[model samples]
Target: MRDLSPPAPRARGALGVAAAVLMAAATLAAPAHAAAAPAGGTAEAAVTAPAPPMGFTNRDSTRCRAEFDEAYVKKIADILVAKGLKDAGYTYVNLDDCWARPARDDQGRLVPDPVRFPNGIKALADHVHAKGLKFGLLAGAGARTCDPAGFPGSLGHEAGDARQFADWGVDHLTYADCGGGGDAEQRYAAMSDALRATGRPVVLTVADQGANRSWEWDGDVAQVRRTTGAGTDGWGSVLARVKQNLPLAAHTGPGRWNDPDALHVGGYGMTETQYRTQFSLWSVMAAPLVIGSDLRKLDAVSAEILTNREVIAVDQDPRGKPGEVVASDAGRWVISKELADGSRAVALFNETNRPRHIATTAGAVGLPAASGYKARDLWTALEKGTSGTIAATVPAHGTVLLKVSADREWSQLPPLLDTTISGDAVARPGTTQRVASAVTNHGGAATGTVTLTLTGGDGWTAQPVTAASTDRLKAGATLGTEWDVTVPAGATGRHELTLTTKYRSRDGLTFTSAIPVPVLVGVTRPPAGESYLGDQAPLAATNGWGPVEKDLSNGESNAGDGSPITINGTVFAKGLGVNSPSSVEYYTAGRCTRVTAQVGLDDEAGTQGTVTFEIWADHQQVASIPKMTNADAARSLTADVSTAETVRLVVTDGGDGAAYDHADWADLKITCA
Candidate 1:
């Protein structure tokens, strides 16, 4: 089967939390290995959205492609509606490539392939509607699809093709292309416009497919935004596709969905357990439950899995909030969703072959730990009695979906808001640095009221600026502003900032988001020389790091301020370097000339933690160690900073946990001429 979306390396972890201002600077700093900058800005986010399709879909590209015609489509529709899929929301039958002829008629309109659909597209659509089912068609956004058969695409003919689709009473149009026309955002928007002009409501779908990061910008232009590329049949393919959409959960909701391609249940290369896993995962993610398998060959196992009314209810919940991975370890994965009614939907996934025991407490998922709730297994449709923790024995590649309802009302759409600050991380003791703050709405509905208050950090003067928004922000939309932060003259140490966001949901529920932001400033600009041994350094700290003069944990400072860091098990912060390691530290030297610092990975070299130390001078890193395991010895590093005023020390986890990142600067000091 030909897949409409292109393939690429899998990318994960797109969302994160708030860090202190100064630490955020170190973590947000450009990495040594940086990718190309994003091409589209916030404007690309879909604003005006079309009405969403509230039903499940079945597409041909997964198995049959465009091989079958009128008889085959009607047969599948009959099976679905007859088997009770229609009432359960499986209502669309989509026709993919090879459905159209190579060329249009004399009027330059698309013509159905005379051989495949001799009865014409309108006739088939009519047949579909006669059964109370909707019709869906697939076309490319370019001159041609990857379809070698030369089926005329809807690229330059968006309006004409759209008009034809509307006239034929088509209900769904999946717009995918190989990128041969203008901007992707514009091309898709054009089709949306053309379809709307026809005066018929069509569910327009654009394949975001990782190429354009379409999930971020494919605002309401289309009903659903395809998040991943085409999915394969096997379990490896299924898990790969599923994990890739983890960080993207924030970008999807009610009106728009993050597609993980199709569902291969009881289909080619799939098993009963894989089927359950796929179905359960899709439901929690709020993904479209499109059946890519054969509806004609429904077995007891497949039918039982598909018609689970309880599972379907979770998917079609009115709140429209998607589920996300809360905790993962070894072969066990835990995902959670906050249902509209304040209930909780939790799934325990076993990825390995052998059966595994997985358990999670209600409190871990926002439910009161001590509060007892009724637990119902969506798979078995049986109550497991009321309990605080729900534990299950799951088969390999199998999933257990549980709907936990407590006595307390906990209904809310959730917090889909994330804020980011940009500008300068470095500020002079007496001057101000103007930075921008951006808040992205990744939930289902608009935010009620958003307010930003800046509580200034230590050793600073000027008043802290604040901002707020009362207007409701659209899903996938972003709002931002600039703030002027000043540092008082002769101030010292690290400046910590507390940025708070107080907002309400559409339901009039109040929510507050407070984040810590740290700012770095040198005590003196120039002509002031400072020196200290590695363990005796007074450096400002970021996200996880504490005051440089002493260990915040107190336990790790046992090596004494005069000696190197010796005791392990105290990793406070991990820098913004690779994999967002366990912790990160940033330091700046003022008016330093030639600085020689003796850095050691661990004072207790006998420990098992791994730590790497790096020195940064101005824009480029002067010296560094990449792989520092527990057994590696320490060394002295010297860098020339005569022409520079700021230098940073970055520490990272060495492909392991930060339990032993007992780094120490024995003889760390900077002197000016």
Candidate 2:
């Protein structure tokens, strides 16, 4: 899987080939429109080509260090075919890392480790193909694989590896986790064009691991993309992957699936029930049916769970629509998927340690309550009968997967609850403030009376506020309200305004949802000629949003003024490297005329590194220090920020890099003209 790392040195020719692939994509990219559907199940979706492989994969998920030889690969392929997996859409068995030598041959050709694959890749492909299953291999975006001893990956060798795999009859090729280097989008596109040149269809799987937010860029390239990191064995790991992929349902469709790594079932760290939870969630998401546990050591319960046709059918549904996590509270959650025949596959999960009694009406889950629907348990394969209200007692970490079909058409299901708090994005301290909130009716029917409360810490108050109260709200309706809030005097930091509301769903189950309102509370303006920013009063940054940080290293490196700390303060902003941008913002009741400070790098020798400081008046960049380095010496800095309502101080990395780009803003001050 990919990670968040800077572009590392890549193969020599990758950039050149990347340019060519971009030109091809610009000309070939086209959107697939929604197509007509047949009644019942089995309708095809409007999907892009080289997509919708509808198969299985076995990576090293079960055993991170498990290395299989050619015989074991064939054995798994034979097992897949024998267990009727091939017929049910489990058709691809991929070879991960460890199969090839670390370096290429004299001719620069990737050579599989002779000891591991004596018959070579071609013979293995034949064996997989003979079993009516497809064969696949792995490559990385970097020059080397993630494995220290793994073969060189497919960076510059894209043109060669793509052709070689096609020649060997490989139908699937996974660009596994990168070597934490190079432009990910460009490298993947290079391989995309190379595979196309062979005139053979090969499905591309991008296991980019969400590093560069690859989902947005890889959509037009890889058919299936990994939305999370490499999978590990543990219930926490299983749930961790699930938590990452559920919200990305909107990004998935007919041919594209948001892979949450794989179905690492029947392995250590998970119980029988937890295994079913993993299976149910993957199926609901229309994910690949790739099971990574050793097939040779399958037990009765594991086989029964894996071979469940109903669950597999959800993943293989021809409609190509994936189920999504519609609503969740505490440990109780709901996930619903649209089916091919206008039906819906819904799952209710109890993720906590105690049993939970969950309930939902048919109309609440997008089914017409008027039309009685028949239900069945996917796990037990038992006919669970029909009713307008489907309720169950789900054990901890267990789920209820229901296939609901109605004889008559149903009214659309409403969003369970939609609440938003606005108008408080920015607030001034020491004053009564007002914010607006809008709550909508996303249930099947009308709701009862609702109570809302606004709460905050640090002596904040929201006691006396008036707005419209709701006695009842019809389906799909909205109610608007307001709140007058106030933070304590001199509150000069980012604070959260929480709105806690109690509402009951259409099925009469009450839920408490707390919504956070992010607001920056500013302090009073500094007197003219007074120091408001420096080592002592470091520019307070917005935690999750701003990259600027506070540190005390000026004296340690003799950064500027030969002071250990800020001129008279204790901290300064640092970590200002390339792409490591940091900023501090504060509101002023009175306009500030100018800002001044002393800045320098923290290089031990004072010979390397760079820093660029910019000042933003409101949202506009009014002044900047273009490029300063260690050799440039610590110097006085000034910027005209006159009549500025909001002022921001930003420190940036120098041109070369941020290796030792330590900077200090000593005696930083903002003053009036």
**Candidate that would win on lDDT:** 2
* Global lDDT of model 2: 0.63
Instruction: Give the C-alpha miss distance for residue 316 in model 2, angstroms.
Output: 1.0
Judging by TM-score against the true structure, name the best candidate: 2
Per-residue lDDT over 184-275 for candidate 1, one digit per residue giving the tens place of the 0 to 100 score: 87788678767656556566788645556676555435657776656655665576567667668887665466777777775756778788
Evaluate all candidate structures by whole-model CA lDDT and list the values in order: 0.61, 0.63
TM-score of each: 0.54, 0.55
lDDT for each residue of candidate 2 in 259-355, tens digit (9 for 90 to 100): 8777767665578888899889988987766777777776778877877878887776766677876678755888888887877888988765434
User: C-alpha displacement of 605 in model 1, angstroms?
Assistant: 44
User: Which residues of candidate 2, in runs, are more than 4 Å off?
Assistant: 1-58, 61-67, 384-387, 408-673
Task: Evaluate model 1: give its lDDT.
Answer: 0.61
lDDT of 2 at 148: 67
